[model samples]
Target: MIVAGFGWRTGANLGAIRSALASAQQGQPPVTALAAPHDKLALVSPLAEALGVAMIAVSPSALQSSPTPTQSPASLKARATGSVAEAAALAAAGPGAWLLTTRHISPDRTATCALARSCTEGPAQ
Candidate 1:
């Protein structure tokens, strides 16, 4: 199965999921996701409709983040915690689990580390 994930930012994840789905050699259904509330996922309705896939939000806290239009400490913490949790969850999933996040992850970032771990541990040779 071709599994993919998306972050709150709409465009990037939508395109990534669509590309992954399209590139699959095996016939697999594409699934899109919202970072938080189910209602928020509706924002991507057009993409969902276009891809013929449904959007699902994981956890409410997952949507919270740091770095607002103006940056602050609390915002930073929120972003860090939420990102860490999100990455951890994705890492725990099975192989071929394509986790596409809209957040820009650095090389040593938590999300990046988690994705690397998940991809290595989950996917079967």
Candidate 2:
């Protein structure tokens, strides 16, 4: 499975979320699931519905524990990671999953997205 995870500011709209997803999916595999910190479930549910994928709510601890190569000062302050999008994607994609896309933010910076592929799958056949 490929999971796309998101992180967004409060009051972020569907447009911002859509833009972030578009940026993250460029040259990437189709996403099979959507993920975000549990508190952002309400914010991401619409995106999940639009994508026709299950939305996975990642725990804050899990997000913080997941290793990511990118980091932002603001994200570190808020979630103890450089990029919540990357961490959440890694955490939700299950053990052995790896990032397929780094965090991509919308123009307004209200939303961010990252993608991860499941461990059970190899590169595209």
Candidate 3:
């Protein structure tokens, strides 16, 4: 399964998120699931509905525990992670999953997205 994780500034519109997700998924497999911080379910729900995929609300601890290739100073200080989008994608993709792309920023810089592929082939949670 392929999961796309997201990170967005407060009040960012769905268009910004869609743009970032489009960049992240460029040339990649179609995403079967979506994920974001547990506290940001409200922000992700609309995207999930639009994409017609399941979405996971990953905890902050889970996001912090997941290692990512890209590091962001703001995210490190605020969320104790490198990139929330990368970490959420890794976490949601479950064990043995690997990142397919690094975080991709929206044109407006209001949102970010990353893709990860699950080692096991099946529907994503």
The lDDT of each candidate is: 0.35, 0.91, 0.91
RMSD (Å) of each candidate, 1 decimal: 9.2, 1.1, 2.9
At residue 72, candidate 1 shows an lDDT of 30
User: Over the stretch 1-125, how does candidate 3's per-residue lDDT look in tens digits?
Assistant: 89999988877888998999999988988999999999988878998998899989999989999999999998998899999999999999998898999999999998999999988964433
* Candidates 2 and 3 compared by TM-score, better number: 2
lDDT of 2 by residue, 25-89 (tens): 99988999999999889888988998799999999999999988897888899999888999999
Off by over 4 Å in 2: none
Model 1 stretches with alpha carbons more than 4 Å out: 9-39, 61-125
Candidate 2 C-alpha error for residue 79, in Å: 0.9
Ranked candidates, highest TM-score first: 2, 3, 1
Write the residue-wise lDDT of candidate 1 on 19-78 in tens digits: 433332133323332222344455445665676644445453433432112233442464
Backbone clashes in candidate 3 total: 0
* Model 1 residue 25 distance off true place after TM-score fit, in angstroms: 14
